[model samples]
Target: MDADTPRRHDASPGQVPHDLLATAELVAGGALRSRDRMWRAGVALGRPLAYALPTTGAGSPPMAGAATLLLCFPFDLEEMPAGCGYRKIELAVTFDDESLRALDLQPGAGWAGPDGARVTAFGLGRNRLRWTFEAPRTGGTLSPDGRWAQAVLASPAPLTDVSGRVQVRGVIEHPLLSGTRAEGEVRTRDEVPFSLTRADVWAAAPLAGRTPRPGAWALTGHESIGPPGERLPPGRQHLCLAVDIEKYSTRGNADMIRLQRSLLRVMRAACARAAVDWDACGRQAQGDGYLLVLPPETDDTRAVPHLLDGLAGALAAVNREPHGGTRSPLRTRMRAAFHHGIVHEGDSGYAGSAVVELFRMLDADPLRALLADDQSTDLVVAFSDRTYQDLVPQGYEGLSPVGFKRTDIRVKQFAGVAWIRSHGHAGPPPPDLTAPV
Candidate 1:
């Protein structure tokens, strides 16, 4: 055959060359058509039924044949129950004919009948050809249920140049496939307990469609309910107040520090007006008494503008130092689950109290009056770069009395938060003041 032209299978008599007989033998032996026939012929030719000839010689020399025969197989077979008739036979071949020496071979086996009852062979190479056969399906019926057949092919050397065609010519005898569906639902309930003073009943409702806000701080106060000399149920009412400080971190900025102090002063003034004892309000000089719930550390760098603005207004009222412009606007984003609640005992007598009870009260009612003023708010605060440092008092001033005295306080700087502890006593005095100054 010419190097640039394809060899016709039905060439005129006397046109087929003697050397082409080997190629003809490959075709006639089913190497280019049926897999079963090819296996039978290979067995007859001393080649194992499972042995496939390498397209290239042992030393990697290319095969001298016009085309490397890769695969051959009959198309359709009986379908198992619950199985669809999907047949695919692929062959990787290479063409060495004069007209298509560089062409790659790809032949496939497929079925065409509506029920996959008809089989055909097709391939793409120097050109495309389709071969059809009218043979009845002879394989035993596939189980009514679907079954799986898997085969793996491997070669020592990469089968790069081997190319051939697969001709599937048979009828399918099984039915189409089907699948099963599962049916079912689930339900649950969360019961959170809560208690509130008569005045805070309205504030107990959800804010912005969220759960009711928990109290910011809890105060355990003993009030004499009966005669002064009478021992009426211990003559003291233990009041546990919960306070929730929203945007605590945002308010930790320098500006907000001043504002917070001013707010504290205002709260004190309010307590004075209400004839409430500010000392008994559970005020700790060192750290914020309530635990602060913080989000997992994040990479967000946007400072909360509203928090900064609020701090600015608060500082102006306190007449304290204004936050320098060193504040970076980047604020860490906090998820709802990031939370920490702390309890401070102004009297030092409540340190050994149940922490769970305190936390539960806080979780149930996070907005309660800690100061005599009944100024309820969230306990947790978000901090900004410049303000975070200013609000978080450091050293002895930031350490709780119990923490400073017992040396139980721990301080570390990570992701910008300065942490301190109060071993269990009220926090230390403010930095700007001395014992007798």
Candidate 2:
């Protein structure tokens, strides 16, 4: 009845045609457009919080829905083994109770996008799911430009939440590339450039109160996300570990790619032997390193030391095997640092001061100097004073206080007392290796 609003026509009593009402009902029931429905659903879910889409071209922004929620998960294909046919990614989505219940979730089959990606695995949580995607066959290529590709959740459900805000979180495996190139390898021989802005991201709303049974979500509670009741991911204490390859940049692209892939396989095996549950732990694959987070409630205090011992053992085994290459047999050396403190899961991934401290520990000058001087050491692991004091004194399996020496270290904003432990090199540092530490 507003002056400008259009009103449906009303004819005098019987003036309307016989099938008009039925036709109107059918249209109302089935005519909802996908985009329109998504917009309406998004509005119903809550107020717009924040969202992002991958940029295909410049000047013009990427496509966005009315209440459109866009997400992306980027992979560094250049760091991948050439012709690697299968690739997997774990996705996490978070949303509130009202919005969650309104959803018509078809977990394994819900995703839509590029031709190569498929949801090969998935796990549900009260507010999140561990969604795994296996990219297209050998023809699929992950880009090095950081802004490689993206995925879209085709169906948007009407959401009902009081906060009027939404959130998304994701991680791009192998976000960077190392320098090692294999013989006959066609990859870049120099270090691949990196920048944070080009990173791809994806996010899912929290599953508020839906308790997905064990099989419903793989590796139940490998790492803790948080108890739901959110404005954001609640801050909690976590065991943080940062692992980096020593002199990784010195190898050619082929060698770098192979080294990282082989090292990851070994690392996973080590975690398994130590009962570390690498998959369950919040893990992110850096080009030449990894950032792992273990929630306090799920990871035992002995987890760190046991894993260190396992890593040392695993590295030795890899060295003992016949490496196909002629120029110095490929050997992997690593630097690992451990710390425990408050960390919060955020829109991007895990964040907090503790996480930053762990990275700082890895970059500390003393740790680097120790590795350089001890050419015979294959692995050098450092523990934050708190973590060292709490776990080192308690002898747990292969972990003993004998090899650990205390050291004072500083890097940028962090200055601290830590304990350094060395694992004797399996073989001489790949001869004359001048790679950056």
Candidate 3:
């Protein structure tokens, strides 16, 4: 450990912290100075530098003949040359045996320094690399939340020449890989196979059901209550925005997953922009849509319009742009319902009449008819009568009485009146459903 590197006085003599935990603070601080020096030293010595991977593997390194190496240099690609992202840093080496090995250039691995950088490999190449890195055409920069672009070496051929050190420097803006949109969704490149939220990773594995434990049991009125003591308190009044993608079931599983995720991104972004805390919001994922519960203190009257406006902008942008290499024009529309209700906080999720009404409003036939009737409309928003009376009449930034048509909503167990508005098209909703309640 360097002198400046803090020593853990908490650990007894033989107990050193894991290499990763030990250096996490340094890594987070963006201290690449020493990492660069180490890379340069490895280059001068003409030896392969060993970097620890995030996960553990079998003791033996995969054989050179059996496995290909991915040398990732996670750095800003734009700060470098035009072709630098695709440029391969050739390291001269005598392979124990050449069996058609291909190497990839990727963003730097953890603890790797700038300029004089370190390379870390996750696994051998499993598929052919494709050229996906492109600067944003919309004049957007990297995500303000610290998302970075990566330069991947597309199409791996057998490496013939390998020798010496290859230098990589700078950062560049690439097509949105990950970032927060104006709507507040964390946009991750669809090409990335999987993205896990911190909650996803840290979530406790599901048990069979509510685990019964030895505790103080109480009988309430006519039933036995929780062994933990009393039943959990009911969730406070919250603004619930329930959104569902139109024709979500029409697509195949793969496409459905993609579309749903995209919708979620937009929803999250919109909520964020509306001043609703993404992490704090009670999120319950349904198949094609979700139920997002805002805190009691949220200005629902102000928040709804902001969310809708941002949501419209986000959907428009996504719909206008081409995604991946698929020829299928990405098209999606949503039906959303805004309601306020107290939810019964459950171990798995929130419950209450509010949650039920929101879902019912989303699945309303009138909302469906509206989307089916207007080909250009990408989103339709409905406010429960209570919400409309409380917030809609306020003339918030993006809302107005004239903009919405009053409709009687009756779907499943839901019976109520709501005000509906459409985005991406100009016109009143179909007269059949908008008739006098």
Winner of 2 and 3 under lDDT: 2
Greater-TM-score candidate between 1 and 2: 2
Candidate 3 lDDT tens digits, 1-437: 54323222121221211111011011111332332221110011101212211122223221212122222211111122221121112111222323423343343244232233334433133232222221233442322111111121112332222222222122222222233211111111111111112222111111234221111111011112356767676668888888888878877544564465456556655765566666566667677887888878888767877777657755664464332222346487888889998887665467788888888878888888887887777888888889888876776765678768888989876688878878763222121211110
Ordered list by lDDT, greatest first = 2, 3, 1
Please list the residue runs of candidate 2 whose C-alpha ends up more than 4 Å from where it truly belongs after superposition: 1-230, 322-330, 395-397, 424-437
10 residues in a row with least lDDT, candidate 1? 40-49
**Whole-model Cα lDDT per candidate?**
0.24, 0.46, 0.45
Off by over 4 Å in 3: 1-229, 425-437
RMSD of each: 34.3, 22.9, 20.7
> Candidate 1: where are CA atoms >4 Å away?
1-236, 251-253, 280-282, 289-349, 352-358, 363-437
Q: Single out the weakest 10-residue window by summed lDDT for candidate 3.
A: 17-26
For 162-250, candidate 2 gives per-residue lDDT tens digits of: 12112111222221123322111111112111111111112223233543221122111223354577477688888887889888898
TM-score of each: 0.19, 0.46, 0.49
| Residue 61 shift from truth in candidate 3, angstroms | 35
